[model samples]
Target: MVRYAQTDETRPADCVIVLGAGTWEGEVSPVFAERLRHALDLYRSGLAPKIILTGGLDPRNTVTDAEAARRWVEAEGIPAQDVFMEEKSRYTHENFLYAGEIMAKEGWDDALVVSDPLHMKRAMLCARDFGVTAYSSPTPTSMYRSTGAKAKFLVRETGCMIVYGVWRLFGVRS
Candidate 1:
């Protein structure tokens, strides 16, 4: 668990999967921006030839997170063809669920999953549930840096982890 919780940012996979964070008024939040920054670094390093961005339209925003991410990455000079967008997931569980389908359709089997540090474990587990092989690649420069915030995220992750375990135990796939 300890190792899984750590970010293996250098792992070379078929693609870099950037999980969505909240967007404010159609703009990527700082949290999501940091995630994209890490993924950009991963791409620039030649770790992967492609990136997959995921998220549906959040309640407070007019545009989908995936679309916003696509724009951002394109602005960064990553060609549109190298970046795939899945804009139908509204939660972490659906992120992997929808991404798995996209992966299968696109023939992407293994990926470096990018998200906040505390989210890697459960996200990886969810990735498995959806039939996708993924590695943890949490953002090293996440704004969730304060000790209290980290602790809170850890606790929340614990609950989410247990819930996902139960869901999997019961044969719930989504």
Candidate 2:
């Protein structure tokens, strides 16, 4: 896994929040698969017993990213009951909000938010806004190996962080 700066909080978390990376034909994209693989490692290490996959419906694939991830873990031997699939979020912020609510109900904290590096800042911000105590655990690698693709994601993520920073500052509820 891609190791960022660490602290005691990096110890075993209560849950692993695997953010979606889109799906195609009900299968996980390479980007999403990396997140799952890391999360699986965490689970096997006894870091967390539950994994929550967050995403909404994909018009073309006819299944949510959460479902696709849930299926992956189940196929990998994670019991179906241990996976929580949130199939209502259509965007990054919603991913935190919806999943945060579920976490609140379960009294979960210290959730590791898994996604690519560029996407982590905004995601962690959204997690705070949603009242979720989350920390980033970026995938060690991403499918976007091309320079153009990397630049595009970084720039877009910077813009999203700026926008979301303002949104959170204003205490907007969603």
Candidate 3:
């Protein structure tokens, strides 16, 4: 997990997949914004011709994370037609599954999966399970910059990964 987090396996792909992190008051959180920024960079660099934002409506937020991110990127000058949204995924695996539906519709076969470093390992696992050809492109910087914050995220991700592994073993896909 540590090794995967430290690496950036970004490459040219059919599209860029920006995993949804929670939004705050209808705006992208700093953590989510970092992911958006990295994906935007990848799009601008010609790595991909399109970006797919994934996230569903959280009960706490009025708008979905994908919608918020789409809005943010559009404001940053990305054309509306180039941005797609999977506005029904509430977690990592569903992110890929629903995004795959969009990919199929758009004839996109592969994607660069974008997320924070600590989240990449699990995100990639989910992407693979969902049968999406994905390459990792973790944010260059994380919102969890402090030692305590990083540790907390690591612990949480470790637990989440373990649970996901067990679920896979049982064929309990969501």
Best candidate according to TM-score: 3
Which sequence of candidate numbers ranks them by lDDT, best first? 3, 1, 2
> How much is 20 displaced in model 2, in angstroms?
0.8
RMSD of 2: 2.9
Clashing pairs in 1: none
Please give the lDDT score at residue 39 for candidate 2. 86
Which of 1 and 3 is ahead in TM-score? 3
Model 3 misplaced regions, further than 4 Å: none
Comparing 2 and 3 by TM-score, which wins? 3
lDDT of 1 by residue, 1-174 (tens): 446768574678889999999788878899999999999999989988899999999777899999998888888899988999989998788998888887888887799899987788788878877878888888888787789887887888888888878888898765
Q: Could you say which candidate leads in lDDT? A: 3
Q: lDDT per prediction? A: 0.86, 0.81, 0.94
Worst 10 residues of 1 by lDDT: 1-10
Q: What is the lDDT of residue 170 in candidate 1?
A: 93
Model 1 residue 139 CA deviation (Å) reads: 1.1
Q: How close is every model to the real structure, measured as TM-score?
A: 0.92, 0.88, 0.98
